[model samples]
Target: MIPAPFDYARAGSVEEAISLLGSDPDAKVLAGGHSLLPAMRLRIARPSMLVDIGRIADLSYVREDGDRIAIGALTRHHDVANAEVLQQLCPIVAHAAGQIGDPQVRHMGTIGGSVAHGDPAGDLPSVLLALDAGFVAQGPTGTRTVAATGFFTSLFETALAPDEVLTEIRVPKATAGWSFMKFQRRAQDWAVVGVSAVRANGGVHVGLTNMGLTPLRAVGVEEAVGGGADPASAAARADEGTAPPDDAFGSAEYRRQLVKVLVRRALEEALP
Candidate 1:
């Protein structure tokens, strides 16, 4: 398959990338190109221009800031998976990042790309949601922080403005237990149903992947946990508000049952 031809502009900085996006209304920002390139090849994405931000060196770091760990948007998944700070402070995120695709994909893909792509099946978004992470969007108007809960609006859709560039991700240091459980048919494949559970603020926070139009919080499970329900009872509510797609690998009903099981496993691993 051939993609539509597009003009290319390599940005040296985040502001420049945002500027390029502003100048071309239909331009797409290219990071690792893992997400956009595939869509382009399939003719599902047809942008007039591609603003390449992969060369922006400053946007590829993982550091500690105040009570949070800040990860630059360009930080590669491989780096994230091996980051000492993330491993010690946020092992769930590191583990999830490592589980994405394979070694080659992890080496090329970026945390910013995964989060910004807003793919429902992506591993990182659900973990971020469970961690209550925040994203920093930079544009000509300056920067604004978007909460993970609100960042993902729909399938392959995000709250970022057209001219904004996701600059960094901020996650609070995890002082409690956390776990990620993914049910996949094959190695390095997308999860059929994924569950991320994190003990936060003295309560359990759970997020579901490929369970709805967007990576979603297991509101029913969260409420059940808050109300003193056991893991099995809370897990039973895993499908309460989800709308999983009925694909060939599994039907919606199958996904519902899978999520319940995975959530229970995740909760057991996350809770003491």
Candidate 2:
């Protein structure tokens, strides 16, 4: 399948990308294009123009900022998976990133693109959610930060405005007990059910992938854990507030059960 014809403009900076997006309501920003290109190829997205920001070299970095690790929007998955700061401070993020797709996809896919794409099944969103990360967005007016808890709105949708470009992701330095579990049928395949668990703020944060319309926090499990429930007991509530999809991959019931097992394992690993 071929994407519908569209005009293209390469943006040299975040400001220029935002301007290009603002110039046409139908314009779409192109980062790594891992998510957008697939949708375009299937004609699910038919933007009138593509604001390519791939050449914006400044947006590809991973650095330490105070107690947080700042990752530029254009930082590729490969880089995120191998960044020394992320590897040491937030190993869950690096571990999950290293599991996304294949080598080619990892080298080309950007962390910002994955998060901004807002796919419920994406590995990073759930990891970021579990980490309670912050996303920096630059729009025509100015820049603002959105918490991970509020970043994802719905399936394939996020809080980012049409004219806003995600600039950086900030995650706290979480070097304590953490675990990322992804269950897939084959290597490089999307997760059938994924769980990200991290010890934070004296409690456990749990994020579920492929369990809802958006990357969802396992509030039920978290509450159970907070209430002194054991890993097995807490994980029993993994499917309490989820709407898992019934597809070829697995039925909603299967995912519901799988999440319990995965969450239990993740909690066991992530909890002291």
Q: Which of the numbered candidates is closest to the native, going by highest lDDT?
A: 2
Query: Over 4 Å off in model 1, which ranges?
Result: none
Q: Write the residue-wise lDDT of candidate 1 on 35-65 in tens digits.
A: 8999999999999999999999999999999
Q: Give the TM-score of candidate 2.
A: 0.99
Clashing pairs in 2: none
* lDDT (10s digit) by residue, model 2, range 1-272: 99999999999889999989999999999999999999999999999999999999999999999999999999999999999999998888888989999999999999999999999999999999999999999999999999999999999999999999999999999988998999999999999999999998878999999999999999999999999999999999999989999999999999999999999999999999
Model 1, 163: alpha-carbon shift in Å? 0.4
The estimated TM-scores of all candidates read 0.99, 0.99
User: Residue 127 deviation, candidate 1, in Å?
Assistant: 0.5
